[model samples]
Target: MPIGVVKTERSIVGVACLIHKDWTLRDEKIMVVNLNIGSELLCLVIANGPNENERAEIQDEFYEALQRELDKVKGKFILLGDLNGR
Candidate 1:
């Protein structure tokens, strides 16, 4: 469940988390990256939530963690990934 961001040569980007542990959970289900594209700062998050078949607690924890991460962002952001929700 590794997550990443790809850019072309002309793109300007900065990664907030250079190490995997700094950006993702133990399960590697979620990842966050703070990027500086030119003068604009963006908080980019990629997540993979547990499926419907997963346990309730797992689902709860995933949503809670996701919310906590989003709450920490101070500026503009884009959340894109498979939430595994209905």
Candidate 2:
């Protein structure tokens, strides 16, 4: 899980956890990015998965974490991700 963070003048975004999906763990990738624009915060996560169940689980957890972080922050925040739950 490679988590990367970036900060901007009014926003921050980055990617994390490039897990490859393969029989031998050879080709899977996951990305997470956080953005802070002015007094607002946003997060975007991109994940690769050949397993829908696992993907859903991971996405759920990720969203929870994002919400938790946003709650602790002192500003408006928005979280976005392809949970693939739908």
Candidate 3:
């Protein structure tokens, strides 16, 4: 399965690309992609199951990173990603 994920609204579900599969896990489940809809900037992230310490460091880090990326875009962006609460 793809480690990182970028969850998007159903409107843009028809278009997407799977890339940097390995890049997913290493980069804290973060994936960057070009969403050429209304906006040309997007990123995909996927969170892993809860690790020790009652939290997943990688997922947490990716969430933080996603925020930074969003700040850079500073426009209408689609936040697409998967979170494993269980």
Clashes of each: 0, 14, 6
Ranking by TM-score: 1, 3, 2
The parts of candidate 1 lying over 4 Å away from their true place are 1-27
Off by over 4 Å in 3: 1-16, 19-28, 38-59
Candidate 3's residue-wise lDDT over 1-86, tens digit each?
32334554333212234663422233433444544445354444333323344456755774676666656654455556544433
C-alpha TM-score for every candidate: 0.66, 0.31, 0.42
Q: Judged by lDDT relative to the true structure, which candidate is superior, 1 or 2?
A: 1
- In angstroms, give how far residue 35 of model 2 lies from its true place: 6.6
Clashing pairs in 1: none
Residue 79 displacement (Å), model 2 = 1.7
Best by TM-score: 1
Q: Please, what are the lDDT tens digits per residue for candidate 1 over residues 50-70? A: 778889998899899889888
Tens-place lDDT per residue, model 2, 1-86, is: 22232233222222233333311111123344455557665544443332365666765765566555445545443433444433
Q: After superposing candidate 2, which stretches have Cα over 4 Å from the reference? A: 1-51, 55-60
Cα lDDT of all candidates, in order? Answer: 0.66, 0.41, 0.45
